[model samples]
Target: MSERKPRKDAARNRAAVLAAADELFARRTSPEDEVTMADIAAAAGVGKGTLFRAFGDRTGLIHALYEARVEPIRNAVEEGPPPLGPATPPLQRLPALLDAILCFKLDNRHLALALEGTGSDSPYQAGHYDRWHALLQAVLEQIPGLTDSDFTAHVLLAATRADLVEHLVGQRRLPPEGLRAQLASFTTKVLGSPALPGSPAEQIHS
Candidate 1:
């Protein structure tokens, strides 16, 4: 009974922390750099020690929150319907997956940025990134005559990186729809889809 009580309390505290962190990221207007573990701890109504113990550090907390928020997309790609699910054709699913990722970053801009900011070389170091990359590589392998699925997956995922998203949407203020269109076009080109009029790929082929 004593052991169970501590476990229950730990789980409850963890949930509170995640909920608080999610709310803060959702409503924050200030720079993501300004948000801190202390802020999350205060918002969660837990002591700083509990926050650190629960998450290890700010990066870990951000990762946990990111994983929580991205869970739905993961589920959709894993078992849900066409476009995102496993049943979709690789060619079709590739773009759909990338589009979903781009939209996720756009919707959770600050949180995404914060996660990326924690990395030095690239956000690819994030643990969740490995799962995405592995899934993309497997999908790429299903494409006929496609080579270097590993490298190709890396390149494709880079297009949806959080920092790039922030630059396009946050700095340049590109409309969400416009960004989605651009990514679709880019993916089409990468997958060797027939080039549309005025596309640079079309010009090169011409």
Candidate 2:
């Protein structure tokens, strides 16, 4: 028999779908710039069945996009340097991480709103949220005179919830720079850290 043809191109199809979806959302000024699954499927040059098979549903697709955008921040937290890397002091890292988070939400505001509005449960119950919570809680556990890291992590993450970020940036018109400063200050207060010379908490907005 002649050589068998290679099976269908799953990886290529997935990349195409993600790329198309990213472009569609990147151009979105509002959540109303909604691109349906059929639209993405058409744009990616794939069938609706393939898009569903690859991503399960619209929410799943949205989550995938969120995860993709946030993956770099996650890697930095897991393996990069001071304030984000594992080696950074917990108090410093906490605020720094929050800054990263706030920026991420601001940068991806429209996408975050789309994802946040989905499902009955809090979006924090999903993928990267658990990792962020666990990492933050673990770091908080290392600090002295601090209690309830578990609860603390949940609360901190809530401070960056999509709707709130949207309100601040989209409605209240908070500048990204100003928001970063406010968050850094809030984190410093919550962590009970007096700003020391060049400390992560002190320097986060810098």
What are the models' TM-scores? 0.88, 0.87
lDDT of 1 by residue, 1-206 (tens): 88999999999999999999999888866354567888989999999999888889998999899989999989988998766889987877888888888889989999988888777656877777889899999999999988899998999899988888888888889998788778879888788866333432222123
Q: Compared with the true structure, what per-residue lDDT tens digits does model 2 show for residues 22-104?
A: 88877787767787999889999999999899899998998888888989888888898776889988777787888788888
Which candidate achieves the best TM-score against the true structure? 1
Show where candidate 1 strays beyond 4 Å. 30-32, 194-206
Inter-residue clash pairs, candidate 2: none
lDDT of each: 0.84, 0.81
Stretches > 4 Å off in candidate 2: 1-8, 119-121, 196-206
